[model samples]
Target: SSAVTKNTKIVLNLESLGSLPADEAGPLARYASTIQAQRHDYNGKVLSIRAEDLKSLAIIYDMSPDELTTRLIEWGVLSPGADVASYFDDE
Candidate 1:
């Protein structure tokens, strides 16, 4: 969906996949990096996110979909009515 896709793009554009130099970027960072790479391959097309994929993302980030959605909105990665889960479907 656009939320996942857009957010992924933002995360990917980060210098270090939104990670710090303490040691590792962690699971969320890793997932975001992967998503970003995919987006780059598609020229920034929104990635299709299944429920399972969303679950994995949540697990990695330790957040719920709603929470993630809210965070994405806060970060300006997702706009209202974006319907992240349905964005790729439209494509």
Candidate 2:
């Protein structure tokens, strides 16, 4: 028998969620809500998360706007070509 070794682990930094003000409600908040929603609807599918969702996701993931966007895309949270930083910059 052969032993298997772990390949990779992505660390989620809860601290990243701290940047957004608790009271600040918007796209970011939506993102957080969306994440929870998707988790409940897990079916190995990609869903459209708005810019707000992106922001919220970033906070939830403890990542910068750019970082969160990239990860979210990788995780099937958003479609490609969607710029998370641009969304925040628009606000």
Candidate 3:
């Protein structure tokens, strides 16, 4: 007798709902709803989070503001094409 391992991948889509396995989908949808409920609108952009919002997100992600900022830059969410040095000058 041979045993086979089954693996399932869940991809979340923000634009529209897609077919998802019921067992896993319900929890994911609830989690997404929670996040959506906490979201703040920024200049008409629902997804653009402000620095003040970072306090809550940092607590959730267990990170400091500096760490979160670094991660955001690495993730290409902040300062996508700007040079870091330009933001700071040698004293």
Candidate closest to the true structure, highest TM-score: 1
lDDT of 3 by residue, 5-72 (tens): 11111122433322444453344344555656776422222243333454555565677655654654
User: How close to the true structure is residue 63 of candidate 2, measured as C-alpha lDDT?
Assistant: 78
Decreasing lDDT order of the candidates: 1, 2, 3
Candidate 1: clashing pairs of residues: none
Tell me model 1's lDDT, rounded to 2 decimals: 0.49
List, residue by residue over 1-91, the lDDT tens digit for candidate 1: 4356544322223433343542334554556557657767444423344445655666666787666655555544445555454423433
Q: Could you arrange the candidates by TM-score from highest to lowest?
A: 1, 2, 3
RMSD per candidate (Å) reads 7.6, 12.3, 16.3
TM-score result, candidate 1 = 0.44
lDDT of 2 by residue, 30-81 (tens): 5544665767843323343345544555676677877866754564444454
Score candidate 3 by TM-score against the native: 0.37
* Candidate 1 residue runs with Cα over 4 Å from true position: 1-29, 36-42, 45-48, 84-91
Alpha-carbon shift of residue 58 in model 2 (angstroms): 1.2
Model 2 Cα displacement at 45 (Å)?
5.7
Q: Pick the candidate with the highest lDDT.
A: 1
TM-scores of the models, in the order given: 0.44, 0.40, 0.37
